[model samples]
Every structure is written in C-alpha cells, then in structure tokens.
Target: MWKYIKWGFRITVLIIVAAFLHYTLPQRDIVRITGTYNRLTEVGANSIFYASPDSGTTTNTVDRRDIRFIEAVYPDGGPMVYRNEDTGWIWPPYFKYDSSNLQAEATNAISPKDKPEWVAVTHYGWRLPIFSIYPNAVKIKAVAGPDVRLIPWVNIVVLVLLGLLVLMLWRMWAQFKERMIEPAMDDLNNTLDAVDARADAARDRARGFWGRLFGRK
Candidate 1:
C-alpha cells in the first residue's frame, strides 16, 4: 500500500509538470523588425515629425501620451525616419505638402510622388518602410528587419523537457518496483516458511504417538 501511494504521488507530480509545461511553454513570438532607421533630427529643420495624432484627444480616454525628440538631419533635404535608440518606435515627421515649393525646387518642399496619399515626406535619398500610418492613428509602417525565429527554439526546448519527463517516469517506476513490490514478496516468502515448519512438526508428533501405542519394538 505504501508503495502504491508513492507510485501514485510520482505519477501525479509527473502529470502536473507535463500539464504546466504544455500550457506555459509556447509564448507569443515578438520579432524585432525595426531598428535605427536614421539619427535624431531637429523638430523644424527638415519636416515636422508628427508624434501627436491629428484626431482623438488621448487626455480623457486612456491618458496615454507620447514624447517626441530629435534624432538626425541630412546634408541635403531628404525624407528621413528617426527612431529612439532606447525604444524601437519609429517617429516620422509630418509635413504639409506644397506644390508651389515643389515647382520652385525648394529645399524643404515634398513632392506628390513621395507623398502617396499619406502624411509622407519626399526625400530623394531616403527610403520609406513598407508600413504606413493614418492621420488618426500614430502607427509606423515597418519594413524588413531581423527575422527572429521562435517556433524552432520553442519546439526544441519543449521536446527536450518532454524527453526528460519520460526518463524521470521510467526511473520512478523502477524505484517503486524495488521498494514496494520486492519488500512485499520477501514478507510473503517468510510467511510461507513458517507454515511449512508447523506442518512438519505436526506430522512427526502423529507418527511418534502411533508407534508408541502399537509397541512394535
């Protein structure tokens, strides 16, 4: 019974461990797809980098606010996206497109081709990311970056843990068999030996009584 109880406990622990690993192992994969796009630039130097949304005041709703900073500037007038070194969030500048400045070839003026129906800045040498944002939302469009592969690592770790659990279960069963079953078998053997000794004594007594009564010698 004690052996059974121990075996049950091991099985229960193993089951719990397996369940916990199964539930907690697979986490959401966060891939770092953006990085230092450009250095920090002055607020009004090239174009206005918009951090605040055009609509919907965040004051009463969530009370969330975003802080703006300068990252970098270009020697020539170019559309550049700057990201904070500490935080990976990209903050692009917001600019009013002027057709007259475009025709006059002004330094800060943005062209319509570069401003693809969005709050876009036209910089000749600058490249825009594949991601886009709307006026109401302050979402930054992201292009390709480091491909953080998560599924493979997750699978390998989980498989290794599962293998360990199986090995532990095997070892636990062996221990239970040795401690519980082997001891019980030894006790059974001892009881059988006592019964055999009693039977032999009874037969000897009966034989001696009969010989004495008959007086054969």
Candidate 2:
C-alpha cells in the first residue's frame, strides 16, 4: 500500500510539473488577426489563470476588470482568442509591460478573411472555453506565409537548465543519505545490539544464582 502511495505521489507531481511547463512555455500559432477590443470581463473560477490585480496593467478589483482581447483565425479557419495582459512582477516571469503596444500591433496586423495576412503569434496558456479563458499573446510579427516554422529556442534552454537543477538536487540528496543518514542508522543498530547482549548476560547471571540456590544445576 505504501509502495502504491509513493508511486501515486510521484505521478501526481510529474503531472503538475508537465502542466505548468505547458502553460508557461511560449508557443507559436500561424494566424491572421481579425480584430482587437476591450471588454469588462467578470473574473470568477478562472481568475487564477489571469493576471493578478496588482499586475501593472490590470485594474485593482476583485470580481470584474477590463481586459484586452485579440481575435484571430488560424490558417485552417479555426478561431482563436487571446487575452492581452501584463504578467506583472510575479510568477511565470514574462515581465510584460507593453500590453497597449501589443494591442496596437495586433490591431495593425488585422486582415480581412478574403485577403488574409499571415502573422506568427507567440503566446502561452490554454484556452478553455468552459471558463472563458484564452491564451495570452506575448508577441506578434508578420510572417511570409502560413507554412513558416518557428523554433522554440526558449523552451529548449529552459528545459535543459531545469533538468540540470533537478539532477544536482538529486545528487545532493543521495550524498546526504549516504554520508549522514546511513552512518547514523548503523550506529543506532550497534547500540541496540550492545544493549541486547548486556541484557542476555544479566539474564544468564540471574538464572545461575537462582539455580545454585535451588541446587537445580
């Protein structure tokens, strides 16, 4: 049962890390911007996915705030909406402070459906329609064509550094267990053995005295 519990905990941690990386790492979409606008959105269950109220760009309110939105269409005609918000001086560390500038760029990139102008949008996060949360666009640039490929150099470097950090932590833990915990456990086992030996000797001496007094041995 403990073995299963240990494996389950490791699996849960792995899943959480995978989800965090997927949400935080930048990705690119080849699409054409159709429009941009601002809306007073009500924040509720999905508030965790949005920028904090203290984020430099967002309003300081609890339930509702004005949010910038960019509407776009994928090369295949599928629709995608992106939230334009600053990451503030907080977690994930995008440190974006030019949301208005990004919105204007998105506005300038807008194209009609009949004469689509392809653009590469760099963004992070998941768009869950159920929660009305959209991926936040980080950067936008015009592309030559829909077939242009974008390499994720940032993700590769981040993952490699993370891997090295985890490896260093595991090695430190292993060294501590070997050098400190194992020797302490061995000394404790030796002390217990010495105590058991003394107890056995005392028991034998007690039996001898009783045996001699009773002339049983």
Candidate 3:
C-alpha cells in the first residue's frame, strides 16, 4: 500500500511538471497568415493569459483594450488565431515590445489559401477559447512551405540542464550523508560504548570492595 502510494505521488508530480513546461516553453507552429487586425476586446478574469498594459497607457473604467490578432491556418486547413501583444517586462519573460512590427510582418506574410505561404510562429502560451485565452505570438518568420521541419533545440538544452541540476542535488545529498551524517553517528556510537565500559569497570570495583569487606571470595 505504501509503495503504491509513493508511485502515485510521483506520477502526479511528473504530470504537473510536464503540464507546466508545456505551457511555459516556447513552441513553433507552421501556419499560413490569412489576415491581421486589431480589435477592442474586453479584458476580464482571463487577463492573466494576456499581456499587461504597456507603460503610460491609460485604461478606462471598463476592462477594454485594443488587442492585435493574427489569423492563420495550419497545414491541414485548420484555423488558429493568435493575439499579438507587447509582453512588457512581465510574466513569461519574452520582454517583447514589438507587437506593431510583428503585426506588420504578419500582414506582409499573408497569403491566400490557394497559394499557401507557410510561416513559423514562435510563441509560448495556450489558446483555450473557452477562457478567451489566445497564445501570444512572440515572433514569426516566413518558411519555405507547409512541410518545413523545426527542431526544438531550446527544449533539448533546457531538459539537459534540468537533468544536470537534479543529478547535482542528488550528489550533494550523498556527500552530506557520507561526510557529515555518518561520521556524527559513528562518534555517537563510540561515546556510548565508552560509557558502557566505564560503568562495567565501576561495578566490578564496587563488587571487589564489598567482597573484601564481607570476607567473601
């Protein structure tokens, strides 16, 4: 029962870590730009997913802001909309202040469905329409075609560093046990043995004194 419980906890932790990385890490989507436009959208509870307001930008009493949208389609002709916004010095750490430039690029890269021109959009977020959350586009570049391949080198390097960090922590713990904890325990055991020997000697001396006083062997 205890072993099963331990395994279940480990699996739960692994799942949580995987989900966090999936949301935080940058991903590439090979999409074809169909349009780019701005809309005055209301920012509500789901504003956490959106970028924060830029410095010196005023907000009305109502939660409304101008948000740029990038309309695109996947290779399989599926629609995907991304929000182009300035992630000004805050969460996700893109430090992207080039929403206008990205919008311009998106507009120039626009191609019709018949003459599809693929573009690789690098972004980091989830697009859950249920929560009105769209992935924030960080950068976009024109690609050769829809079948252009992208290797996730960033993820590979990050995973390697994470593995090394875990290994280093494990080694540090092992060294602490070997160099500090084991020696302390050994010293405690030796002190206990010395105490037992002294007690035994004292008892023997007392017995000898009592035997001589009582004229016994």
Candidate 4:
C-alpha cells in the first residue's frame, strides 16, 4: 500500500540522518598511544570524505598521497588507529590545520602497557576496514584515567540548534500554505463552480482546465 511505502521512506530518511550525525559529530575515546608514523596511501577518486592534501607533506602522484597515522590501544587491549589530516576551511568546520602539533601531543601522551597513560582522542569518522578509512583525530590530550567521564556538550548544543531551525522552517511553511496556497485553491474552486453553473459546455471546459492544471483524475 501507499501508506506502507510512505512509512518506509520516512524510516529510511531518519536512519540516514542518524548515521550522518554519528559519523560527523566529534567523539572522545580514551586510549593509550602506542606509535606515530606516516605511510604512503592510495586515495580513491570516489572517496566521499576529503582531506586537505597537506601542502608540503603530500606529493604529486596519481591517486596517491602520504598520510599521517597515530596508533593506539583501548583499555581492553583493542587496537585503534587514527588518521591525521587537515580539514581545511570547509566541511565539518573543525578548521583543524595542526596535525603536526596534535601528533606531538599524542607522542607525549604515549605510555608503556605496564603503566598505561590514558589520553582522550577527539575525532569524527567511521573506521571501515574494507575501505581502509580511519577516524580523523582532531585533538589529543592526557586524561585522568580510562574511566574518566566526558560530556558531549557540543552534540547537545548542535542538536538543540538544529531542532529550533527545523521548527522555524515548519512554521514558515505552514504560514505560506495558510496565507497563499489555501486562498488560491479557494478561488480556483469558486471559478470552477461558476463555470459549472453557467452551462454544460462551460462546465466541460472548466473540468478540462482543472485536469490540465492539477492532473487530477
């Protein structure tokens, strides 16, 4: 049924929006730094995410570039890898251009497995092994411990602003329909009624006009 299709579309849209926010919004992970290094990476032309192509760091090659990487491990001994790249002046608005500084901070935070020094890595992105994509780290700093609690203030504020923006747009659309669309529709109906009252020929002409205007059956 049309109703089922409409609901399915709505659910699909909601899921996409949720996934987008999850990937774009910054998240903090408490991990112990293990190593810092750079490797030559081949970038696909179809990549949805864009990096700054660091001025001096990246060399001219066909779909290939040098990428900085920071390796770390979680409290549970699980491995975590992050990519260091400039976001430039666009998209995500992190405006991060200090990959070197962050790398240095991460290097300072590195501690051995016996005396693990917990550091919170702030980043945004999904690590898809199939695509060889890693989360881009924006900030790195020492934390009290792996159990330290971190609040997502940025997400809360951003969500609130987005809700207000949607509400404002909905109100504007309602006003437009009430003030313009409804009045025009009423005039159309009145004209059609007048045509119907005049004669059969005129009624046929009006029906033809109506069908042409709205494609109504």
TM-score of each: 0.27, 0.91, 0.77, 0.84
Comparing 1 with 2 on lDDT, the higher-scoring candidate is 2
Best candidate (score: lDDT): 2
Which residue pairs collide in model 3, if any? none
- Badly placed stretches (over 4 Å) of model 4 are 54-57, 199-217
Per-residue CA lDDT of candidate 3, range 1-217, in tens? 9999999999999999998888878999999999998888899998778776762123554588888899999999899999888877777777888888999999999998888889999998898989989998899988898888899999899889999999999999999999999999999999999999999999999999999989964
Residue 35 shift from truth in candidate 4, angstroms: 1.3
Q: Give the TM-score of candidate 4.
A: 0.84
lDDT of 1 by residue, 101-168 (tens): 22222222222333321221122112234432111111222223224232447458768887999899
Q: How are the candidates ranked when ordered by lDDT, highest leading?
A: 2, 3, 4, 1
Local accuracy of candidate 2 as per-residue lDDT tens digits, 115-193: 8899999999999998898999989999998999888899999999999999999999999999999999999999999
Model 1: weakest 10-residue lDDT segment is: 116-125
Deviating ranges (above 4 Å) for candidate 2: 58-61, 207-217
Error of 3 at 212 (Å): 23
Looking at candidate 3, what is the lDDT of residue 187? 100
Model 2 lDDT, full chain set: 0.92
Note the Cα lDDT for every prediction shown: 0.39, 0.92, 0.88, 0.87
Clashes within 3 Å, all models in order: 12, 0, 0, 0
**Any runs in candidate 3 off by more than 4 Å, and if so which?**
54-58, 181-217
**Which prediction has more favorable TM-score, 2 or 4?**
2
